[model samples]
Target: MEYILGAVGLLLGAVIMYFVGAGQRKKILEGQSQQDQSYKLEAEKVVSDAKLNAEKIIAEAKLTAEKTFSEFKDKQEEFKQEKIRESREKFQRFKDEFKQEKEDELVELKAKREALKEEQAAMKEERASFKADRDEILKLQEAVKIQEQQLEQRNKKLTEEIERARQKQEELEHQHERFTSELEKIASLSQEEARVRLMEDVRGKTENEAMALKREILEAAKEDAAKDARKVVINTIQRMCSEMTIENTVSVFPLDNDNVKGQIIGREGRNIRAIEAATGAELVVDDTPETIVISSFDPIRREIARLSLKRLVTDGRIHPARVEEVVAKTKKELTQQIMEIGKKTVVELDIHNLPSDLVRYVGRMRFRSSYGQNLLKHSIETAHLCATMAAEMGMNKNQIKLAKRAGLLHDIGKVAEEDSELSHALYGMALCEKLGENPIVVNAVGAHHDEIEMNNLISCIVQACDAISGARPGARREILDGYINRIKELEEIAKKNQGVSSAFAMQAGRELRVIVEADKVSDQHADELSFKISQEIQETMQYPGQIKVMVIRETRAVAYAR
Candidate 1:
């Protein structure tokens, strides 16, 4: 019974194990089927997505190819159009060049035709001259026989005249002898003595008449000369009417507002110092409303400073480095402007062939002053005056040009960069000569101030024009103290000379009259003293125009009857 119960339990256990295995297998199969279905749906979705992606990619490729083709076509069309334009331009250029060539050829042909016509006319004239010469020779041949016949008649008349003259000569000799004898009897003197007395009387009377005539002629000539000189001077003065401008050492740089002054001054005044150091000018930024004073003895420096400040303010980048850069650039620009001014001045003056160095010097004259007169204006005035005077004197074109050039360059030495001990006139002369200027121009430059002897008419004209320009009323001015000091200095220069009793400055220091004691200075010594004083003044003093040193040595006899 124990064995049977064990078997039954084993079988029941086996059956239960079988049933559990079958249930688990069925659940595994259902899960596998669900996974397959899920995977199949996922695969179907992936395939559809891939097909859509392929279609999209293919469509994009087609669009790209079509776009590329269109681009290529557009590029090709553009290339064709460009080539066509190039060809058209080339053809037009060729046609124009050909037309120009044809025109040139036609011009050449016309010129040749004209030349041929002229040659033909010359040949015709030569032929006509030949024909006329032939006719003249024939006429001369016919007239030669007529002249021979007339010569025969003249010879016969001359023979008859010779015979008549011999008979008249004898009669005249007898009459002369009888007259001489009668004269000797009346005068009670020998023939020779009476002849001598008559000659002396005639000589005395003729001498008195000639002296009187000479004095009258001299007086008349002097009067006419004075009148003519006055007329010319008056006309010259009237013809020229130039405006006057006064220049000062300081320049006023106007600002838009006072606010700009702060930028110009900068932090700690560094900007101001930089500008001053760079431009060699003083910037006076004071309470002056909307203005900065640029103080400098050199006008160029003032101009540079003014322009540099203007740029800095306009640029709104004020700093030490920027200030230096602007200043340097301003200097360069000013230099170029100076050159342009020089070129323009020369062109306006109608002067040519001036060296670049001389042109630069001429430009510098715009910044310079002489005796308070603007040097450039003075030079221009002098040039015009010189040209006018030369024209008035009937000078040739070359001479007039030379006069103008010399007048313009007369004060170039004042603007020269070199340190010169010589006077401006001499230094200018040297400068011109060094630059291979004309000899007449050099002489005029040197002799304008009488520093050297004038060598030509042009030199004299330059000197005269320079004087006229300077001596014009209101052309120049001087400080009162300076003017007074100049007058006193003129007098002192003359008084210091030996044998000078007293000195007077006249014509606003244009003339110095020195009175010398007659006992101390003779007439010859007076001349020498005048020359000495002039030399001393020339070497020691600087004056506008020229000073006339006149030494007066007159003896006054004092015998008063009481």
Candidate 2:
């Protein structure tokens, strides 16, 4: 009974173990199925995504190809249109060229026809001249024969008259000799003595009459000359005014601060050296508060230096390269400035018709000064003065314009390059002529200072204006030292001449009074000496207005205190 109970218990245990393993295996199978479903869903998702991507790539490729094709079509159309336009333009150009060529040919033909007509007319005139010359020659020959016959008859008649006169003269000679002998006897003197006495009487009467006549002529001539001179001078003076401005050779440049002086002087003074060499002026960098001096004998160069230095200091980029660049640029700017100034001056002067190059020269005059007078301003003033005087003098409108234009350009040559041998007047005239200025204007420019003869009324007007402008007091200022030296030179020149014992330049150097040694210089010789001194002064000295030379030779007999 114990063995049967053990077997039943084992069998029950085995059945329990089997039921639990079956439950676990069923659970494992459900888990495997769940994993399979998950993998299947993942694979479906990957394949759908790949198919959708393939469709997208293919669609994109088609779109790209279509766009490229459309663009290419558009380009092809553009090329076709451009070619058509070019062909049309070429055809039009060729047609226009052909038409122009036809017109030119027609014009040439017409010119040639007219020239032929003129040539024919000239030939006909020449033929008529030859025929007329032949007829004149024949008439001259016949007239010569008639004149020869008349001359022969006159010669024969003159010979007969001469023979009769010779016979009559012989008879009269005998009677005169007898009468002269009788007169000599009555006068108790020889014929020569009596004739000399008669001559003395006649000479005295003639001397008195000649003295009276000389006085009358002198008074009349002086009266007329004074009237004419007074009229012309009064007319010019009343109508004109000239203003002069003087500029110095050195220019002062203002600085912002003292520190910039280093930049201007630069390393080893290269900047300053470059500036000096470029502008032909010396730059004075000194220990002042805030100023630099540009010194040069040439005002234009000094001006350029001052301007360039100002710009460089303002820019604060001072170096050799910067200095050179600024100077060059400033020079161009200054040139342009001069051109503008010249143009405006011309306009203000109411003058016109100047050569373009001459106009540029007029602009150059702004920087040129003569005797402390600004040349450009002087020129403008001269133009106005000339115009006024011309109008007052009853010149025509065209003449007045010419006179004014000439006055404006009269001193253009003063701005010519230094060391040029030509005088300003001649040089300006040459420049005007080269530029095709009016001949009358050229004459006026050259002849205004009497360097050449006055060719027209306008030239005379220019002369009058130039004189009035320069001769005005205070128009020119000579340095005091130079003026004093000039006065000394005048005295020296006068004293240097022979027979001039003492000389004094009186009337502010307008007149020279010379005391000549009476024993050495005669009254007649004193007049000659005065002329010589005047000529010497003219040749060697430069002065305004007239200089009179008076030479006195006094002869005094000492009979005092007897």
Candidate 3:
């Protein structure tokens, strides 16, 4: 029974074990079946996804093919349109060319017809001309016959005249010999003596007439020269205007009160001395109320001192230190002022492109004076004169510019440093040449004063302008006494002549007019007197430019017509 129970238990246990194993195997098989079903479902999903992708790709390819087909159609249409345009253009060209060829053919036919008509007309004209020439030849034959008859008549007259001329010549020779013999007997003089007397008589009568003729010729020449000179001078003067009064080397500083003079003088005169040292000008603090005189040979120095004094007075500072500081500052300012003045003057004159250094020298001319005339003003006046003259002469623009430039720079040498050995003209010339001025301009600058030879009309214009400016009345501001004395001397020189009733020095002693006694001095003698007086003046007097001597001998017959 234990065996059977154990066996039964064992079998039951085995059967239960088998059943648990079968349950486990079934669970495993169910898990495998679940896995297989999952795999199959995944495969189906994959296959469905691939089919969808394939359809999408096919749709995209078909869309691309449709787009390509549309593009090809558009390209084909464009090409057809291009071909159609090309064919139309070719046909139009051919039609135009065919029309032009037909027109050309018609023109050629017309030209051939016109040429045939012209040839026929020319042939008819030739035939008419030949007939006219034949008639002219027959008329010429008749004229030849008449000419032969005229020659025969002229030959007869010529022979008779020749014979008469031969007889007349013989008679004249015989009469000449008889007259010579008769003259020798009556005169009782040799042929040479007779000739001398005859010549002397002719000379005596001719000399006076010759003298008058010479005077007339000289007057005519002088009139021509005077006319030209007057035109140039009048034109120049009309164009250029400058200050009547010229620059001077002395400056008068007006003080606000007398107390200011003392400040300028300083303690122990140290202030005045310091100012002098700084400005190179002489300070004259005279008793003249509200006035301090600044004096210097150099106009620039005097100007600086005047300006510095004015500045110091304006600032109400008066001391040696202040004076010096003010002077230094004033100098710099004045220097720049000078440069500006120069630049302005050039601009006003319409001159340009000068070297900077040359311009500075030109600025220095503002402070420079020549014979009491301000050099800078003189230069500007000269430039105006030159430009006017150049215009009147019809010079081109470049020549006109050169004329003005040369005239303005002509006196630039006067402002050269004190130690320069050359005269102003020569110095200015050298400066211009070194500064690369035009050769013609350089020549004019140096030759204005005759220090060098003139090479152009510009130089002559500059000289004339300078003379006109300097020689004009009231141009030279000199001592009153000296001017009066010189005028008196000039009159005395003119009065020394025997024919003079009265003498006057006109045009600021530049010209002398003499009134002679009509009875005592004849017109011929008047000429002689003028020549003598001019010669005496030249030999005895030292004067600027030339002196004009005029002798007037008027015969006045007074009659009362009341």
lDDT of each: 0.80, 0.76, 0.77
* Prediction 1 global C-alpha lDDT: 0.80
Model 3 agreement with the true structure over 1-562: per-residue lDDT tens digits = 3333443454455446545755775688677755556755665565566556555555666666677778889999999999999999999999999999999999999996797688679869989998887676556555545554654455454445545554655565465456556667799878767556655665455545556555665576556556555654544443332222212556788887998877878886768878998999988788888988787777789889988988888998788889989999999999898889888888888888988877888899988877777888888888898899999999999999999998889888887756688887888888999999999999998888787788788888888877776766556665567667778988897787776889999877878999999988877788778987887887787776688988888888989988
Give the TM-scores of the predictions, in the order they appear.
Answer: 0.43, 0.44, 0.47
Predicted candidate 1 versus true structure: per-residue lDDT over 1-562, tens digit per residue: 3333444455566556556755765688677765556755665565566556555555666666677778889999999999999999999999999999999999999996797688679869999998997686566545555555654565465445545554655565565566567779997889988666655665455445444544454465557556555644444433332222213667889999998899989986778978998999989899989999898877888889988988998999999999999998998988998899899999999998999999999999998888778999999999999999999999999999988999899998898786779888888889999999999999989998887888799888888888787765567786567778888988998887778889999776898999999998866567657867987898899986699988888999999899
State the TM-score for model 1. Answer: 0.43
Q: How accurate is candidate 2 locally (lDDT)?
A: 0.76
What lDDT is reached at residue 125 by model 1?
100
Model 1 poorest ten-residue lDDT run: 238-247
Candidate 2: tens digits of C-alpha lDDT, residues 1-562: 3333444455555556555755765587677665556655665565566556555555665666677778889999999999999999999999999999999999999996797688679869989998997686566555555555654565465456545555655565565566567768898988998656654664455444444544454466557556555644554443232111113566778887888888888876678878987999987888878988888777678788988988887788888888889999999998888778878887887667765677778888887788778898788888999899999999899888888888898898888755578998999899888888889989999998899998788898888889777755556785556666777888988899888899998755777899999998866567668867886897899876788888988877877685
Candidate 1 wrongly placed segments (more than 4 Å)? 1-247, 287-289, 478-562
The local lDDT score (0 to 100) that residue 342 gets in candidate 2 is 76
Q: Ranking by TM-score, best first?
A: 3, 2, 1
Sorted on lDDT, best first, the list reads: 1, 3, 2
Write down the lDDT that model 3 would get: 0.77
